[model samples]
Target chain A: MAEECYTELEQAIQVLVANFYKYVSKHSLVRNKISKSSFRKMLQKELNHMLTDTGNRKAADKLIQNLDANHDGRISFDEYWTLIDCPYMVYPATDLCK
Target chain B: MAEECYTELEQAIQVLVANFYKYVSKHSLVRNKISKSSFRKMLQKELNHMLTDTGNRKAADKLIQNLDANHDGRISFDEYWTLIDCPYMVYPATDLCK
Candidate 1:
């Protein structure tokens, strides 16, 4: 699809899905899953601004452990969606819509 | 936070969260929830490109019915996340990262 045809919301969703694939290793046994190390790197690089503990290895590891819901030791798209809960952290002070 | 400080991924996430609040009624009895009518308008305006049935009222209603997990006639943030599953529809042809 043409980039110009996408709405801002559609483009945002594409950015999210594309970011996940960008960090997914091609050599992994799973086709579209992100390995633990890559997921950590993603947190540090892509989400450092939003997540306070991205710079803390231990905290990041704990978060990864929690997100690995299927015990597959990797993050799937569904697993990654769980991080959306952190929007509270992103807008801590005010209700933007209010 | 300054707009320039956000990574592309962070900005994308903010867009998703903000879009939800934009449709949410300020006077809702339960704060932050989006009513059925507002949610439908959101689908048509924000997600028309990604969701083929946005123009079809029956289809959109069915989709909202499925998304309203609690059957409360309104959508919560968690319910909104379910729509992310449609990333498959957004990138139908090619492996975008490959």
Candidate 2:
């Protein structure tokens, strides 16, 4: 793909989508939804910096509550995007890091 | 500011948030919302590759229609996030570019 033609925002969005697949691909037997354990690993490994409490299982559970809209205890792409968008929309990244 | 500790997903979220402020900063006197014209410019320059129809005024306006939830013709951060999350959640970036 000729990625060079894509602007920063477009490329950034691609990075986000690609990151989801990256984790899903690492786990076998799952393509559409991330299992509960896999989602935990994703939060700890990929979102540790943004979510300082990712190591806390209880906090992680609370975070997943809203994302798992169907209450299936699994995360679909839509659910994952919802998780990302909520904080991304509310807080500045710099402040989040601090 | 110790960015090295941040994971790829964390940084990607930062990029998305920073992109919003980048445009907002460029246009003075407005910190909370992007005017219709500024939003158009953002779509044209930042999403041209992702949204091929960005060059068309009607298409841009139509895209903004849903984002402007209050019907005020301006995009607040929540509305902007809504606009981005819709397609980002629905389509794969590679497919969207195609």
Candidate 3:
């Protein structure tokens, strides 16, 4: 349950992250340790324009529903984390691919 | 557990959203229904610069750990959502501030 949700958050963040790839990626505040190839790979998914695009946040809202998983009508930190923590695990894997 | 977690997500997002104040908020994709007054308030918190600043994402990493909350070492969507959902509840109240 948790893994599925964070997978979604990572999906959403990566989509939105494309928004600042050029600016934030080079800023050093976040780039010193993270590998560029992993960064690029994360940036590239669904990247015709925005892997992070909320093109129809209806999709986002629905995912929010999924994150809430238990049907509590509100998402708890645990549920939400499941949705967003995918990158922690994914980045290293993407690096291995490179 | 959930409320405490989303409280954190909201806290972190407001900080990050400040980064896009000049650009993303003005964009139609995300702003249509999310009230501007609430938006402004979100932009203002810890606003010397970045409410969203990862100035020391050590803070963020720590929070991520909190979202994971279960000592699971990996955050699930449930945990992540809790950290980021506070704004959804706070916005209507912030509009009342206006």
| Best candidate (score: DockQ) | 1
For B1-98, candidate 2 gives per-residue lDDT tens digits of 49777776777777778777766634556667888888889987887666666667887787778678899877887787776777633463322222
> What TM-score number comes out for model 3?
0.22
Which pairs of residues collide in model 2? none
> What's the lDDT for candidate 1?
0.76
lDDT by residue (A7-96, candidate 2, tens digit) is 767777878788777666455565678877778888888876666666777767777776899998778887888878775334533222
The candidates, ranked best first by DockQ, are 1, 2, 3
lDDT tens digits, residue span B1-98, model 1: 79879899888888888898899888847798988889889988987777665767777788788889999998998888777655544463322122
TM-score of each: 0.88, 0.81, 0.22
- TM-score (0 to 1) of chain B for each candidate: 0.84, 0.80, 0.34
Top of the candidates by lDDT: 1
What CAPRI class is candidate 1?
medium
> What DockQ do you compute for every candidate structure?
0.63, 0.58, 0.02
Candidate 3 or 2, higher TM-score: 2
Q: 1 or 3, which is superior by DockQ? A: 1
Chain A TM-score of model 2 comes to 0.78
